[model samples]
Target: MFTGLIDKLKGKRTAAVKTPEIMGLRLGASFELDPLAIRLILDELTIESCSPTQIIRAAGLVELDGTWVYRFYTDDDAWLQVVAEGGQTDEHVVDVKLFHFYDTLDVAGQQAWDRLLQREIGAASYSLRERTYGRVWTSAGDYHNPVHMAEKTYDGDGEHSLTDQFTMLFERPLSDQRTESLFLSAEEKQEQAGYLSRSLVISTGITLTPSQLTIHG
Candidate 1:
């Protein structure tokens, strides 16, 4: 009777483990690692011979239906999104929406931006060409409508446009100096992008989190 019961339990355990099919993936906010020691619950271990278990919560990775999803983190804050591929990978190619300037700009400034976009005025704006591969922050082409508590399907005013989303940050400065050219042989120019990327993270108060990677198959 004990042998028969053990066979049934093994069958159940095998059925519980399944491979996942991922159509797409989204990463959530990151949390610090919390290592906790708890009781052993594996079938091989009894309380008398159990080993401690530690819970590490780093690089917010969640498994849905056995599929693993990981969060993107920088120095300041975890990329805030319910579903995301990650944040920008290339600093040179940035999405306009990532700029804090747009959200905080005054009405007059917004109008000025509109005019500049319309070619009515001349001004420098953050722009970069669209890239196929990278984090979610790389693509700001779609405008997310805010949820309205009062009503459903209410899209207020004008939708955020991505037509003018890409531009060089230091266009003029870079052009004036060969040191800034992407094709330039200078190693310094190659490193310049990295420096700027980190500086942007620092200026934005994104406390860089330590890298965390967890894989479960």
Candidate 2:
């Protein structure tokens, strides 16, 4: 079944991507790609068209666990990760980790994470906190730390839904502020800001597509 997904993808001719090298699955070699490339592969595999059941039922979960546990970063320094465990389908559980670049876990925060794991906090709940350096302020003139928050969770291994886990890891809320931040130039940022300011948050792919969103200027 795992080989079938690879064969299907390999059979499709994507001009620039060179599907055979996606993981060298043809040879039964383990993942040898870097974090970004792996993230891109996961992003493609977990799409709506791909059956999550097939993925979970196959050896894919083992690959995901063995290879993807390390942190993966975005261009802006934000990072995310996923780890799967258990041998049986019903026993399978996945842990997702996301970290915004600005938020660094302190010694106490690290201990808290360790305790959270020790206690096996359930999936329905999470802990979030703002990091600060005393009364330090940023050059942006907003609150010193601003209202930005990083999201990283450590949940206990147990019975879980892989589909639900996929959604949580891939889909993200879209808003004007986030759209505005995407712009690199001042003019572009100002242009998108007006449009995003009038829009409401919606669940959409982080890449931004017109199909799932309609922002007004």
Candidate 3:
């Protein structure tokens, strides 16, 4: 009976772990490792043992058959969706969606954004270009929305926009310049694009759980 219980527990373990090191890489802007910094963050994270189903449910990584879906809430009240399939080795295998909280914006600003969308003024197939971060769509493109939000006042009371509000709430920085030009040394634009593609995937979201071992046929 003891052996059987151990087998069950082993079976309950999933193949993924969510540690601060992984989270830092996932949510962090840069892909390059700062070994010391990563070590420090990892040391601070509280480690625990839990079943795969529990961990997945807690982290919002739901599994349906062979497909896994994860959702992450960004600093701007925008939610990002990531869907992954089993055995997929490519970064492009992950599907990303940005859900903006439009209701958070004021009437005038919302209208301004609506007009831009109506005209198809800044819609792009991809949320972020090879060189930008956050929702890249909008009238101003890339980081413009956040910057605009910072400059706007609520009821002319010198208050920041909803974007700014969330940023402060989440303690996420407005900008991370360390990895801004990580791909600059690449010999070609294609190389730079490839690097950015991978970096974006790595910096999308973070998890704070332990890794699990699983057996596969």
**Candidate 2 Cα deviation (angstroms), residue 12:** 40
Could you tell me the lDDT of residue 32 within candidate 3?
A: 23
lDDT scores in order: 0.21, 0.25, 0.28
Which window of 10 residues has the lowest lDDT sum in candidate 2?
A: 180-189
Which candidate comes out best when scored by lDDT? Answer: 3
Q: Cα lDDT for residue 109, model 3?
A: 46
The sequence of per-residue lDDT tens digits that candidate 1 reaches over residues 83-194 is 2133322222211111011111222344444443344111222332321111112224332111111101101121111111121122212122211101000001113334
In the range 51-136, model 2's lDDT, one tens digit per residue, is 11111111112133333232233332333333435432212425433333323222234455434333322222222232111221
Stronger candidate by TM-score (1 vs 3): 3
Error of 2 at 184 (Å): 27
Q: Rank the candidates by TM-score, best first.
A: 3, 2, 1
TM-score of each: 0.19, 0.21, 0.23
Worst 10 residues of 3 by lDDT: 180-189
Query: In candidate 3, which residue ranges exceed 4 Å CA deviation?
Result: 1-59, 88-94, 102-217
Can you write out model 3's per-residue Cα lDDT over 1-217, one digit (the tens) per residue? 8877997888965344441111322332222222332243332222111122111111133344666544433344433345557732335234533232322222234454445334322223222233342233344442222111111112112222211111100111122221111100001112333431111011222222122211111
Better of 2 and 3 by lDDT: 3
